[model samples]
Target: MRPSVSKPPACLLLALTSIFLNAQTTSQPVISADARTVQLERRLETISSALVAARQQVDQSLQQIHELQQELAEIKQQLPSAQTVPPNSSSSIADPLAALKTSVTDVQERQDTLEAQVKLHDQTKVESDSKYPIHLSGLVLFNAFANRGNVDNIDLPAIAISQPDGASGGSLGAGLRQTILGIEGSGPRIAGARTSANVNMDFFAGLAYANFGTSAGIVRMRTASINLDWPKDSVQAGLVGPLISPLSPTSYATVAEPGMAWAGNLWTWAPQLRYAHQFPLQEDKHVQFEFGLWDTPSSGYNTSDVLRSPSPSEQSRQPAYETRVSYGTSSVDRGLQVGLGGYYSRQHYPYNNNDSWAATVDWRVPLGARFEFSGEGYRGRSLGGLGGGVYKDVLYGTNPVTGAPAFVGLNAIGGWAQFKSHFTQSFEANAATGQDNGFADDFHSIILPSTATSLQLRARNRMIVGNLIYRPKTYLIFSPEYRRIWTWPIYGQGNTADVFTLSMGYQF
Candidate 1:
């Protein structure tokens, strides 16, 4: 301003200078703000991309979890109830990691179980294990039997039909007619209970030959039944042991040795429907009650032998009933057992109606370490099927004037006792004696011919048997036995028989 010496435009000069200063300060701040906006946009873009990727990954994980759950459900359905997952399982978690962990654990458990199942199935299918669950049972036996007098066939010796004393010579035979085979099965459970079935067969089929009257044996059904096991209760239906005589003295010598007709062993097989209930009294001790309705209590007799071994088959219109109550020391039959039993039946004859009844008691005791004793006693009338009353179910006599048949019950008493000792794990010995007594007056009243063998109904029948068995293994046995049988005629001299037998068996 001094150089130009201009004092008139000082205001204009000041305004121009103010404008220039404002522009300089605003330009620097605009550049710095633009740099910060660019940086913020880059960070936002990165965050958005990460969120989208995470959503896709989570979707895939959910799909995988769903598939896994479906598989687990399928596995559960196929598995038996015994392998059911626990209700309080922690697999219901919400966290993905936790849920996945649970799924993995469940899958592993199911896999293990499935593997075990597969293993079992594989084992069962093997030739050696074809009957794994259905375990093969029973024995194969050959017997050499010799008798003092001619008797029945290879198996049982008929005391009544035996040759009268001093009338005939003795008999000897060897046979393989006592082999036993059976199949038993344990299958899938039902209603929280186990189910089982069995079919037992033996070669004791009477007097049958394969061809040309050869010794080739015929097979017979011993027992075939199904068992449903529930808690403390069971139901059985089929051909089974008689309720009145559930236990028999163990015999390897001959199948007949256990219950030879005159031996007072009231053992038989009949079709039956039975129910059993068990009540626990204390540790290792319990009580059981059983009852059954059986097939008509017929003597299974026909024309030839009907006179003496008569049963009220023609009159037995109603089923036989049996009931039993027992106390035991253990679940298995190894310990003491005591029981009482009853039987009732009715005969509906066109002209006569009768009731047959019986009361029985049985005991099995374990004496000390290696000894055992068993006994049974029964009182009844006309118990033909049970081998009592001289094997006559009901007494019959002809009405002298009416020319009609009449029947009366025959009073009877019977008992048996057995003692057994296990000399060692591989050796055993036992003795048994039994008797059946029938009222002699009833026999005398019958009108049949005096010489007719049926008229000689046994007033007293007794048997004693002693045996020793050597079992090198549980499935193999060798036995030798001696048995003496005696029968008293209703009014004449009695007859007796002596039997010697040797047996060898292998059980499967």
Candidate 2:
């Protein structure tokens, strides 16, 4: 206990000295909240000094009380009886002990109050530094489904164009495969530019996911990117959406429907490096010019066997190039945006050559506060690498000219439009339609033998979708959608299927 009294005073004295030194070291005449912060520091210094002085006085008083207690104990030991003791001696001891107890209580109370104030001050400092803080965002999704007709690979199956005459039945299942996780951060400065970064992933991809059922799913990368900007120019690099299709419709049924991918929606994500510069027209209004170079989409290795078709990577001889010019009144809600873009890429063939390209116009116009219209349209050849043309790049068959197999290129036209209405802050509805049509004549142009009539190629895909969204809170959403798809393949007349979907999600 004696050592404890000395230790508290010594530690508090050290703290007071350190606080005083900190106050002296800060000489800036910074103003606003900074000035207030300095003022608070100086006040803390004063409080620390008072705490040290009071602790020292308490230590001294405690030492005096200890001495008195020893004296009183000796007095009691020597006393023959209470009646024989001198009245003033006994009274004096009792009086001072009572006062010492009061003094100790007062010191304890004062120390507690000062410590609380210091804690509050520290908390205030932490809050002030917390501006531009990092936050976590993404969602946990649970989906339950029953299909009247079988679809392509399952995890989040897309509409399969297989002829209805096939032996496939139907399926029923539930899963958390669409659950997502992502981290978001901002307020970093880089090379004299403002920088922000985000990374997102989900268990919706992998070889295992191709047959994901009640089994656990494998994780897949969704987005890993960074954006750095100056006042008028910006740079972005990562796995990102192509500028050929700049608008996307909101849908909770993304996993199953893909919003409108195989239809008129040219949707694809690839690694790319992009730069954007803006010409200011007025306040919050500008014309933005963007140019980007994307990784050469590979159409895997090619083989002479026509049965073993080339993968996307094998089709590319060089990286894809794209540029877009768009004008916008603002980027906020109810704003208007319109752009025209183009894409080009060269393809490599064994002792042969092919080229692919696209030209498109994309736009969004808000009819009013509650209604909007948006879409993109493009014409591209061998664009299957970008999720168009039903994933078809070329038609392979016998060549009458060379008396060998030939790879004939294919072309397609695609576009998707979404009309949306927001009836309230918590509820909205969307209707969208799109189509990807392969050139029928181009498919017929392939020099195939009369005996090679078994090729069943897709000629067209069409989709019409309508959905309603209900958001009960900022973090929770519920949506149900109905999608109708019609597909035409050279093998049969056409195949049609209807997909109904419901999804629940919570974002943080």
Candidate 3:
């Protein structure tokens, strides 16, 4: 019976198998549809990427085209006009494609050329703006001064007597006190040596109530010198002004009294040879020494003909010999400077004998800005021999009152102190005392004497001076001054003169 029931078992099994195969076949179509959807998504992504890349390429191409067009325009402007172009056959000129190619090539070449030219121009500008060592500079000074009371007459003869007393009120005058032009240059060594030089001149004119009429004018050599610099050394030579004196180091200030023996009497010019050597005392610290040979006499009673007279004999003779020494510290904070100098000259005139010595001390105190003080003392002696003595007695002495030596020795001592305080940026003041012996009495005896022989009565005299200077800027200065003079050995009785002066100076 089981066999009969199972007779369909195999067939039943086959039927089950067939049902499974049909189900599997039906699932394949759905799987294929999903695969097609994925492929379509991938293709869309690829197309989007390609579109973005194409847009970027188009933008870059447009930028290049814009630049090329600008270059083409510039090249056209530089091309020759019809007047410069040679006539050609119509067939040759009709080839627009070749002409366009040629124009494009030319524009490219011109753009490259212009870029190179701009670079060259920039390089040239940089070179021209570089700093050089050569320099040209100058200074001009305009001065105006007025005097109240008696002013010393510089135009009178050196032997003239009597101070002029007229028109004591006021006067107007103008002058170029220091008209200097010069050139300076420095550079690396050439042929193992360095060289430099400076040349200057002064053209001056002024008006005063004097014998030279209402105006006095002159042109003089201010400075002429050449300097040679070695590794740490230098040498200079020429007709140079004195290196001494703080006020009148370059040129004499002729506005002051003439005969008084301070800065005025110390004024003179001479030829000199000078040498300087610098040595390092420490790192960034140095000390210098200078020595000079000033043309002058050795000693005795001989005069300098070049200074006193222009005669050939005088021109060749020396005037005097002057020596100077100075020492300075490397540290400005140390505030120390000391110097000593002297001169000895033979009498230029028969009875004139001259010898002078001076010492100076200057100190500075470190404060907010700085405070400075300096003092100088000088002494001089003039000897009058027998002939001078007789001249003095006859001119100044009463007849037969007593027996006296005709000649006498005249001695003078002078001192001055200067103090400056730099308290603020806008203001500074300087006060000085310039007084000497033999300023007034010599004037009365020699200038305003009652008799001709009164010239012999010249003796030691004194002048007291005070000055206050205000400097608002580096190039502008205003000074007001006062002077009092006292003469000794009264000839026409003791005479004194009080002088007040105001001076304004501008420089650029």
Give the least accurate 10-residue stretch of model 1, judged by summed lDDT.
124-133
Per-residue accuracy of model 3 over 303-373 as CA lDDT, tens digit each: 75346534211343554444555555555433445656554434333343333223332223333344566
At residue 479, candidate 1 shows an lDDT of 94
Write down the lDDT that model 2 would get.
0.74
Error of 3 at 254 (Å): 6.9
* CA error at residue 227 for candidate 1, angstroms: 0.8
Error of 2 at 362 (Å): 0.8
Cα lDDT for residue 258, model 3? Answer: 25
lDDT of 2 by residue, 174-224 (tens): 677778888666776878899887778888664363444354567888767
How well does candidate 2 match the true structure in TM-score terms? 0.68
Count of backbone clashes for each model? 0, 11, 19
> Which is better, 1 or 3, measured by TM-score?
1
Worst 10 residues of 3 by lDDT: 385-394
Per-model TM values vs. the true structure: 0.69, 0.68, 0.51
| Alpha carbon deviation, residue 55, candidate 1 (Å) | 58
Residues 149-215, model 1: lDDT tens digits: 5554445565734465676567777888778888788776788778888988877666564656555
Prediction 1 TM-score vs. true:
0.69
